[model samples]
Target: MKKIKIEPMELNAVKRVYLLGIGGIGMSAIARYYLHYGVPVAGYDRVSSDITQTLEAAGANIHYTDSVGAIPTAFLNREETLVIYTPAIPANHSELEYFRSNGFVLMKRAQVLGLLSSNYKTLAVAGTHGKTTTSTLLAHLLATSMGCDAFLGGISRNYSSNLILADQGKQLLVVEADEYDRSFLTLHPYLAIVTSVDADHLDIYGTYDAVLNAFQEFVSQIKPGGYLVVKQNIAFKPTVGKGVGVITYGFTPDCHYYPTNISIHDGLYRFTLVTPQGSINNLTLGVPGHYNLENAIAASAAALTLGVPTEKLAHGLESFRGVQRRFDVRYRGTKIIYIDDYAHHPSEIEALVRSVREVFPNRKITGIFQPHLYSRTRDFAGEFAAALDKLDKPIITEIYPARELPIEGVTSETIVKLMSNSNAQVVPKAELINWLKCNNVDILLTIGAGDIDRMISEIVNTLEAKENKAINE
Candidate 1:
């Protein structure tokens, strides 16, 4: 654990902090952090869930409605409070407008995080899929070695919380740099890791090239004398100045940091970490999934640059329980196994299916997937269909419209039509539970980045019951 000293920004004895979209994993971590600092926190979310209840129980005032009047009186005092919001929020949000018109010091969540990181020894992890897991691993590595305060994108299974180690003494800060809306650009980090530069957020970037350009812009923000670690085979070449050092890490030998002689024993991956200094052998990951191997390599590269000992790095990764919803194994039995993964992009889905095939070489894999956004489905219909077609039996659900309104010609049918596999079917969300009841499942996987999470518990329970009945018989 290493602590970097930051000059404290003086506040005018502000008694309250208000967060819009406070229920989001990243937003909630900030909320919890503010609460830990003894600031009275209050927030508004579009819906109520387990997270909001937890925050409310932990002493923050929360309401589900969007009514501007629902805001607490203390938070409404402009001179003594700060309002923070997420870009996922609709532009026309009433509370946002109220804060704006009233002259309150409103800031984007990324801006606030950037402001926090500017004064600390920050380690920001950026990518399309593995950011959360890599950031969590890096945070755990630093926290165990020295200490770090982290604001992560997913709840770490090890900590059961999205935030970890809030002490100011351990100058290290770990942040998940979200690529959506070009949010990662705000962070100026001491050590930064780019895990993947896949073309995601097409609606925002307009094209794959634009997305790559945004990532390049982000790389330029690395502080002078800082370290930048990038995954191998990424399309773009970064142009950097004198002080910053660049390192490449991946599964291939050309990378400065790569894995050597990888093997899976008893269902756990063991690989030698080949770094610039030397190779560290027999490194094991607590979480399953070969995609995570590359992520671990990337995290290890950055953490080593931050001065974590190779032995400590091995221990931290081995002890990591993984982030929730990233290849999360819910139930396992000899006859039936159920897994859920938050893989929405085509590349992610391909890697996920590949991992499953590798792990269970001879099993029948039945995959159910819910597409995340209408824009994404419309933009990558063929790619999505191709990825889903890889499975033995693929079930499709209606698009989960997170922020965008439904596009005219974009629907589940668009994707189903593109699939060459006849096993694919467009299924309604309501009928899925019953549908699965009658169907046979060997290795079941539910994949997506949307409300598919709402069904995880039910799906797990149903599969568990089937397993129990077979055992009893």
Candidate 2:
């Protein structure tokens, strides 16, 4: 069996860090990591976002243009600077070429993160789905009990930042192990958690088996004698590291860790969490939705494995607010209940819609989904349609091409054509606000991973206007 070892970069030698895609969620976190140490930071992003703006305010020199001239003169010294880039950046990018030709040290975002986390005892959460929420909750639990640093995949409502710096001991670091581009392979964590292993990122893995293989390989990197806390019945049975003990958590009673006496009130759930040690009773989840129960279960199991005080469990979980865009409630008006989610996958959409129905029964559900990538739209058009059909009214928006070029026949209408719902239609983002203004909505869900979040404020304002109009009439 081949093993992976990450050699840590000597941070003492590097005077400054330069990032290629500085505005990215993951990239921005790394920039903050550098800034925390008082190291000089500079980067280039394709656009200026709140993330970039925040970085600029924090002593990071950032620009939106891709030109080599945008690079700061001070960072031009090859020996003193380290460059990190996201894989989403195109190969033909001029700035990337300039950095390459000039002999600057370049590493992927994951590689640089590996260098940073290499110093601390790492707790990593990896999966194609369910990782962000689970990791965020895990960070909260540990943060409350014993302070620990975290590099999360989403902006946590509790911390309002993806990077969580421990105020005291930096003994432990929690990281959301990203599977895109096989990036999770960087970490050899003290504890590793696998939340789900569904087929995704086909453009990168090429097949379902490859995705499984990558996950199996990821778990194999767990440190000797550490624990592997995984969801029961997941497809890829991990090949854990030497002396690694496997623990399972799931909805079923057969798992090592599971829930009991599950009950929902209004929208939130209260349940008794069952673990190998003993049962914790009268536990209430801070977030809404039944699907979040699995995520909570997984996080709790990991927390318990790391020796988190059992008494601190319930209070920590009750205070956990959840990650942004992971079933985030934008508006709860008398006329419309709006939720915005970052569910770009078919199975995720199905789960979100199913949970919405569970929470708001008998209410008319309208789902607004933007296809994230043309390749994904081409691959799972039928499945997407089936998931969207679960809603009373489904709106498919124009595809948001994040990193891939548009395919010839794959469009937002592709899913609409395959959908059985008579009310399903295509609405481009340019006219989405107008469509929302004219439409009647009961429980509205704006879903996707791209620029769909940009429309959330406008959609909420439109809903408010409609409510005020009905009152006036």
- The alpha-carbon RMSD values of the candidates against the true structure, listed in the order shown, are 2.3, 3.1
Query: In candidate 2, which residue pairs get closer than 3 Å at backbone N, Cα or C atoms, i.e. clash?
Result: none
Residue pairs with clashing backbones, model 1: 1-145, 1-146, 1-147, 3-170, 3-171, 4-171
lDDT (0 to 1) per candidate:
0.87, 0.89
Stretches off by above 4 angstroms in model 1 are 1-10, 166-168
lDDT of 1 by residue, 16-97 (tens): 7899999998899989888877789999998887788889999999998999889988888987788889988898999999
Candidate 1 Cα deviation (angstroms), residue 109: 0.6
TM-score of each model, paired residue for residue: 0.96, 0.97
